[model samples]
Target chain A: MEDNQKKYTELANRIYDLDGAVYECVGSSLGRTFTGGRERTVRTLSMLMYTKPDGHLLRSELALISNMARTIKNKEEKSRMMTEYNEILMEIEKLPDVFGKVDILDDERVRLNLAAKREKLSENDHLVICISRTQGSAGNDIGFELADNLKINYYDVEIFDQVMKRLEADKDAVNDAENFVDFNKYTKKSGGSLKTRFREFNRYHGLPKQDAVFFNMSDLICNLAKTEDCIIMGRCADMILKNNHIPHISLFISAPFSVRVEHIMAVRNMNLKQAVRFLKKMDRQHRKYYQFYTGEKWGKPENYDLCINSANYGIKETIDVIRRMIGK
Target chain B: MEDNQKKYTELANRIYDLDGAVYECVGSSLGRTFTGGRERTVRTLSMLMYTKPDGHLLRSELALISNMARTIKNKEEKSRMMTEYNEILMEIEKLPDVFGKVDILDDERVRLNLAAKREKLSENDHLVICISRTQGSAGNDIGFELADNLKINYYDVEIFDQVMKRLEADKDAVNDAENFVDFNKYTKKSGGSLKTRFREFNRYHGLPKQDAVFFNMSDLICNLAKTEDCIIMGRCADMILKNNHIPHISLFISAPFSVRVEHIMAVRNMNLKQAVRFLKKMDRQHRKYYQFYTGEKWGKPENYDLCINSANYGIKETIDVIRRMIGK
Candidate 1:
């Protein structure tokens, strides 16, 4: 990371004005901003275009800035940093520029054919989207809305219910106060069933039972990957779909504490104290669920293909940005 | 949480249009705004007043808006929320007329307070900060120039060094990589020195080495804190100084993956790959250390007094906002 920073800082120092350029980069991102500025002005413009609604930046942009902002002395090293930064952008603009070095993908089963993935892409191309979010992070609003906008089969939690029904039919999975525990604990005699094992795992982790009423929101989100294109929320699908890269886009949405509190307060009309209680509870539960399932902390930013401040760039714009990224 | 939300929503609906005749009941919260405008316009204006940044309202015009904003059915609840939003601010704000019974602290703790800790403030203040970032998130840059305007001290850290030193001072007391075989192992050791136990706990979780340097950076930061106010990049000082809630305001700065990546690329001059790598590596270390010490997800908005989107707010304003938040 330090080495990375050195590269960026050196580049940052070279650019006298950042306000113009940053905006131009952003303009390119959204398309058709008022242009007619030199590179110097465009450079500084980027600094002025200084906001993302939910906080977090795109991976490609991060590379450019990190290299640009680095602290460096040796001109050779500085040039090398610039080269590396450029290579990354050019690679992301289409891929194959990086050759076949697949990074950020951990799944051993994934077959990499970057070109194939690219060729298959279309405005209507299907995708497996994993949205891992904080509890009460308004992920449902974004996820469901995204599916609605995409005009594909939308599934917030209904998908999990369907899966659970199939999984439980084989076994006498009953729902009770300890529904999750019982379901997770028991299965058919022949290794029970996947649902039973999952139920047992859920029981182990104290997850809600996979009843018609008790759903696995996370699993529902991940199953979208197996299907064609779908938007799933808060289930670490990015990591799950790691092997099948390309069409996969991950997003982490968050907002400032005050803004979130205000939204909760206004929407729910909860007094401040109650709002705090609810927000904390949801955040904690989501964190636990994330940790339990992924063995990794949620909202860590690094875990996702994208981390968006739902409050900043917002849900609709975020979707638009992703659409643009996929060049759809 | 839902229940609380329902209650708040119900009350907010009622207060949505308080009549001008009910001025006495509403108190000074809606003074002039209620006097002349149509009730609908007044309500819309009231909502806008709260939502928009206080610039077009103007300094002189703010008095009326402030009055209208202050009008509330539940002063106690509002005060409590206000404190939570800006603990230091409530400590010093002109308490609302119905501040009593709100559990608002009169005898507030007087430890080191930050300029950023102040509430309802928007003045520019110079700040020095330290940061502990995740591997794939460009969190270090916020710390990079946070001290650009500060007069006193600054220490930026990728790894927490002070805690490492504490671990090193007592190697037997601390676990040194070899002790644990599983990733889930965590210390719940009690009846020992808090410092020693924390080290033992971090060891089981595969946290960075005790002498990784972030902990020492924290020590240096805290030492800096002992004298003047600074924006701490990271280090579980909020947890470490749990008792001393006043003076120092701990801020967890983050952005979504894509945003941060973009930020790293532009700011650090890194290629996409290196930026992603840098963000992930540094962020993971920080999260591990943070969760290990704090027993809370590091970047949860609630854990920190202020959680800002460096991408949303931009680095300079984030620093400015922090300065204002801490009331530096």
Candidate 2:
């Protein structure tokens, strides 16, 4: 019994170590900072291992660890590990569950449910254009020109201002959202108890401020769609509008990596490497944000009515093409 | 010494097993067939282990093995293997070389050298357009119309016919290329000595018929560019022309995955799932072929002067956008 306890503890320690490595790898790959949530999750799983926690929860956590292992750079070792991993899974499956059940906490479900409850507008009743673009793709320039060409209101940063105004009624929420952004940007190492760290991680990952901002922004977008014909840039407006069954033409503007890199270099006065790095970071952020909010793949053509490589048609012609697309 | 030999053999066997797994994974992932060259490579490395082979050669071979390991789906296993993999690298680096030096064989080098030797037409001396596209993106229709609008010769499968005619002079080469394609399409298993198997793998992976066809098609593309303004579709004409330093406008056409699937469904009468699968296979083939030949990422904006989601502008507007970009 003592030997078995030691063996399980060793397994838990290995899981903890692997989870950290994966968290760091995924964070660096996405150009984001690693936070405390993953570690907390790992600790929870580690503790629950003794009690024979829910198999599904255990499998899901282990699956994440496995994903990181696949990134291993050596073949012979990888295969050996894979074989061992298969054995571990078999062992896990055989372990009888005797403890209290642990339910998976999915905050995204709440957001999705809220989205599903939105009042959908008739297809032709609203004219909204949502432009999602990669950085330096001239998406903003094109979106502005498109709105001008069609004589419609254009919402970009103004949407943020509107959301902030709405959040002003709850000053603490606004302050928390602002602080969260600041924390994400500047906080490298966080200090707290494991429980507090886990809560902080959940607050950032699952949302409190970010979620509040997103939900409020979503409401503003739907309201605008009902009130007037307009063009909304970023903010996952395309998805928010879609959630409401509002008639909107979604456009994804992208240019080749090199072209966009060049554009960034020219506009931002950054060198090639810096521009590339900046673009990758921005692209990742947009993708993550979109995926997080909408549960849809961003920049995928089926999601959008029209997708354009804006570099193919210069800014003016890109606008012209959109105008023609809308038959204006 | 006997123990060392046994240990090396064990390492070799592990490499062989892992290499087979990787080859199968990559082939299935790309929807291609696994050829024999990889096994031969593994055997050579195994044999060389006793003699102390070139560190670079051994490393490169191991690198391929390592790449396969990255595909392992289990995280704990992946991490464990990766750690062991790093240790193996340290061990390999510590080994003393004591045998004849082996040089890496790269057939792509010869192709690249041949490309370098081609005569470059001055910019503005040639007005050539190359269009590369995803399956079911209406790239062909756009290319045909763009050619008609420009009053230029449009080459599509005609390039294949022309290449076939060129290869006819070398009937055996033509027969080999044709037979190779048939073999790739139909042959499930091959039985041969390791040497012959390796050679067959090299022939397919590196080139003989496919390479010959590619080179001839390249020559034709360059020659045509030098003589007249024309639009070339597929056939890596863009890269071929670029390699020759011939002036040309390259365009990549794409539509959203769902949109393309619908297009294929309507055009080919395939159901949604079938169309999706078909599109994915075709896209993978084109990507593999393009990468194999050009050594550049396919559908990257930097490679092409313009890329359009044809679904955005439709056939006519898409053509118009291209025509306007060229100041037609």
Q: Please give, for residues A1-328, the per-residue lDDT of candidate 1 as tens digits.
A: 4653444333333332332333333332322222344454434433322222211222323323432323344566545544554453343324221211112222221122111244445664456666665543455556654654563443433333333434454333423222322333233532556787677756535643343323343344445455556665543456555533434655666665655675666545578999888888777656654565567777764454345444433445445544543345
Error of 1 at A128 (Å): 1.2
Each prediction's Cα lDDT score? 0.43, 0.57
Q: What DockQ results for candidate 2?
A: 0.03
Q: Residue B259 in candidate 2 has what lDDT?
A: 67
Candidate 1 TM-score for chain A: 0.50
lDDT of 2: 0.57
Q: How do the residues B1-328 of candidate 1 rate in per-residue lDDT, one tens digit apiece? A: 4653444343323333332323444454313333344645544433433332321221112222222333446777445432332332232122221111011111222122232223422243223343444433334444534543443333423112222324355534333222211122254431357786577568645444443333444455456555544445445655655443324545555655776676556555588999888777656656666676557777654344334444434444445544443334
Report the lDDT tens digits of candidate 2 across residue range A1-328.
Answer: 6765665566655666554554454442421111346556445655556543233335434543443445556666555544655565555444444111211111232222211112433444556788888877777767755664564666764334433554466434444234323333224442446687567557555665556566767787888778777778888887787677665666778876767777766555579999899898888767777787778876655455446666555666567656654545
**What RMSD does each model have against the real structure?**
19.6, 33.4
What are the candidates' interface root-mean-square deviations?
17.5, 25.5
Any runs in candidate 2 off by more than 4 Å, and if so which?
A1-128, A141-152, A166-168, A171-207, A226-229, A243-245, A256-277, A300-328, B1-129, B145-152, B163-168, B171-207, B243-249, B258-277, B301-328
